[model samples]
Target: MSAKESGRNVVAGIGVRGWLRFIWRQLTSMSVALMLLMLLAIAAIPGSVIPQKMSNPQGYARYIEANPDRVAWMEKLQLFDVYTSVWFSAVYILLFVSLIGCILPRIRVHYRALRNPPPRAPKNLLRLPAHAQASGVTRDDEEMRRRAVGWLRRSKRYRVICDDEPGGALVVRAERGYARETGNLIFHIALVGLLVSVAIGQLYHYRGQVILVQGRGFANAQVDYDSFSAGSAFDPASMCPFRMTLDQFDAKFRVSDAQAQDFTAHVTIDDNATSSKEQIKVNHPLIIGGAKIYLQGNGYAPEVEVKDADGEVAFAGAVPFIAQDNVYTSLGTIKVPDVTSGDQIGLVGYLLPSAEQSESGAWKSVYPDLLDPVLVLTVWRGDLGLDNGIPQNVYELDTDNMTQVAKDGKVVTLVVRPGETVDLPDDLGSFTFNGVKRYVALDLRHDPSLTMVLIASIAAVIGLAMSLFIPRRRMWVRIAGAVASVGGLAKTEDENLQREVRSLAEYIAAPDKAPPVGPGQAIQEGKAE
Candidate 1:
């Protein structure tokens, strides 16, 4: 082939090969890993900036209510929920692939280096980073080589070699820290392991919360939970179904003081089917079958008893209410479908946990702990919605279609205390506030696959340590024959041998005689005087 044609073929081959090599190098480079790290950080930015759906779905609804336009814009950009965004997943996937690409090859390289010998020292010892010499090391050539090798060996540099040629011998040296390269590879791989572990945790774990009433029992089921969610691959059946039954909940607050610092709840829990009863305090919890139960808190429900004109028991139960004040609180309820000779009567009342009379005779709470607790009742004699399919709150009376008959024109609001009874005129019967009983709130949660996540995290740490703390290095040495140069030796006889002439000269320092350097140069120039 002609030179030009051959060159064309060679250039074409190189172009193709170089492209592949560039790709391989990029995949294996630390720069690529660092860039992936940056990408990962950027991907995580949205998770923190945007409220995750799992943490607060209703809170986002509130945000939407307040900032309709802003919420719309954020939703358009997937900011309201970014964790499940396609862009974030893409970033993590690409990072994982690149990390594996870099780590797998490093493993092979480390294995080979461990099994192979280190390179010999370089022939030119003076060219090394640090070098020194001493003619007094030894006079005999073999003795010199032995002494140099001995010095290096004693210094812990293994595999020291002595190379003897015509003129002299050069020493070769090496050490056993070559396995440092493997340590570096382990460190990198360990980081990749960490990433995998976190991804597993995100994909296989289950986390949610369930709020149950004090007397109620909540099963660790998806539908029973108030708000529940699992990882992408989590199985609902695998969730810890450790049913917890609240046997009893006890709460005692500090004596009606300014600061109720001594608030605590003692709970008795029955682990479902475990047949074991556990007592749990405010801070302590009972753990059974991977489920934990605690006395989270408690609230009061005013106990009321209702009766007809014939003294027939109409209603006798506790009505729970949310506290209005931190200490002093408000509790209220509406009663519908009161029967009187096959007719219906409606009643509404506001109960105060600690009822206190105001200057104007209006009733309100002075504290949360039912001190002189009272209820204000207003009765209406009409349709109590018993015929309607719509449900009514036992704590609330639907007065959408009822009329008041007790001391008012359609409605009346008043207060009643414990042992207090209010009679209904026009055959509406009566109701009484007997006392108050406290109710408790329970929260349950279950999560699976935390163990897998932890294992992956630990493996990643080990791999990272191995990869970072190791370095790869080698040295080479070769002793070539030194050629004799008689012509050069005769040309610089006086100048080259000047140091020897110092012994021949009487004085080491001279005032004249062309100084040692001048005469040495003149001799080289063949201009001897």
Candidate 2:
């Protein structure tokens, strides 16, 4: 290789190394840390605004169906799953690395500083921020120095050092408040710990929700939940071994507008080795087997019995109704896919707890309580498209291929109250409204690192308090011949240093009596020079 080519290669390597160092320094700067934190916060907005598929599959699906044109773009941006998105994870991971790089070196420097004493007394004490001079404390230099050191030691406030100057004057250097620096380091370290705790908690967490009607039971298994979501490192087999049976659900409402006041679920739990009963209410959860169960909602489920044309019972169970208003006006759908005689049937309509007729001949609900409950259903009969193996929304009925059953040249309408039976049109079937039962929604969650997160939060709070409240300062007392000079300096601009210097001079001048004047007045007069 020629010498010019070799020199060019060397210069290129040096350029690359220097560029990398610059990048590292910028990443670890406090400005970058604040920016990354703000970016992380901005990135989390989509998680709350858009429904996540892992938590609400039905709602998410409906959203996609409503915006068919945006699905591809939204998927590419990972808006549906913001917390687990690759870009979000990268941002937080980089923040964690930056904090580590910034805090570790500060901790090392602060540790070394604590082991060393304060610097020697300055040469020109008159040039300090606050200086005080006292005469006639003692005629001998040795006696004045002894009294000053004795007074500083008795106060027990500063780290004192006594040394001899070139002119045979005694110089005493004292410093305190190393804890100020230590606290600053600790605050940064705690921030790093908080980030670690949150990351670990996210990795090992799992949450699932289930809806159980009165007299229904649930097992803590993956298949038993209506919807379950797990972390990236979560193991399904590690689920808590427990079973819950809901005995009763009670909902209380206010007198006006039927606003809900409280909801409580009475449940019995079995952990295979023991059994216990607990009442779970809003904001108060039941903790068992490292998992917490919370009560989120309550609604009414209408029980019904259906029979085909042959009089054989086809369906008998309670169907949960989704509430649409504060007065418990609910919407529900019932599909009978296994009828033995004729085409399958589907029923769709609203369940009114307090049924009322409007002036325009429309039926509506008047109250949340079941004062006079009624079911107004529209009947359809045809192919339900159930055999295609595609999942269908349980709450919605697809009637694209169904024929509406009518009676006397009008569309058929079945109105049934509690314990009422009505015959279907075209001799299709018979339907009866049995009764109404209450149901409660429960969420179970577990995270192994929650304790660490709590500890880190407490540490961060304490470090923050110390870093803000503690002060860093230095003071020096020098005795030359019969005169004593004191000077003070503080890390921050405040009046405490001036006050402290004047007080020390007074204390040395009058060991058993109060000084004649205040520290502030003395400092002002001295500054006139």
The per-prediction CA RMSD against the true structure, in angstroms, equals 13.1, 4.0
In model 2, which regions exceed 4 Å deviation?
1-17, 49-53, 63-81, 138-156, 356-367, 383-392, 399-411, 515-529
lDDT of each: 0.55, 0.83
Off by over 4 Å in 1: 1-29, 45-55, 60-81, 124-184, 249-272, 279-445, 458-529
Q: Compute the lDDT of residue 295 as modeled in candidate 1.
A: 50
Query: Would you list the clashing residue pairs of candidate 2?
Result: none
Q: How do the residues 231-309 of candidate 1 rate in per-residue lDDT, one tens digit apiece?
A: 6777776665556555555445566563445443334333345545556565665554454545555567677776766
Question: In angstroms, how far off is 291's CA in candidate 2?
Answer: 1.9
| Cα lDDT for residue 324, candidate 1 | 55
How would you encode candidate 2's per-residue C-alpha lDDT over 427-527 as one tens digit per residue? Answer: 98899999998888899999877888888888888888887777778888888755788888888765677777787777666535555443332322143
Please give the lDDT score at residue 514 for candidate 1.
39
